[model samples]
Target: MWNKRRRHFESYPEIVIVHVSGYGRPESGGDPKKCKRGCYDIISQAYSGWCKLASTPEHEVYRLPLYAGNYVTALFGAMEMLVAYIHAQKTGEGQVVDVAQFEAIARIIEMYYTQCIITLEY
Candidate 1:
């Protein structure tokens, strides 16, 4: 469907498409079965290691109830869409923005961990 629409890019050059997926680009290389599987908030959380961030004192990992992975993906997607929109407006060329939920969650998790380490008391 997107491939077909891409063919008409010249017709609508200002189009800024934002695609949000659970894993990532289907062709980016990974388990083919996982690429085809339907995604949920919890699935992305687990895949991105977001669940591991919320462990008990015993270190038993668990998922958060706030759907942080899903929300983060959406926030990232919206930001990308805005950037793409700006580019389209300037160049009169359309662009596709792909936001992976797992990667998005991983990004935030990495940032948080980095900050924690930076502020860690010696």
Candidate 2:
């Protein structure tokens, strides 16, 4: 007989967990060099597309005021996790995961390619 992992909580509920627990320097105001080109725009489009595809009912979703805000939150969350993992691996205190901005953006557009390929088949 196979054993299954125990559920953390009974009656599992759907939720969006944005994990942003890690250390890093916050961006200073009006810093041009601190910003990355086209990254913000890409993330915004990805986030909006994600929200649109979410299974939750419209009434239950909390839409962000601006797509830029969503992008920043997602970017920060990814950075936090990546930094923590890197710190841990170097010091033998944590695991490291390499998440490049370009790769992440490419993953977000996987469906776009699928759509392009599939639509032509019809």
User: Which predicted model would earn the best TM-score?
Assistant: 1
Please list all clashing residue pairs in model 1, or write none if there are none.
Answer: none
Residues 89-109 of candidate 1 have per-residue lDDT tens digits of 889888877788888988877
Q: Model 2, poorest ten-residue lDDT window?
A: 1-10
Q: How many Å off is the CA of 6 in candidate 1?
A: 2.3
Give, for candidate 1, the lowest lDDT window spanning 10 residues: 113-122
Candidate 2 clashes: the total is 1
Candidate 1 positional error at 122, Å: 17
Model 1: residues >4 Å from true position, as ranges?
Answer: 27-33, 112-122
TM-scores for all predictions: 0.80, 0.29
Report the C-alpha displacement of residue 63, candidate 2, in angstroms. 15
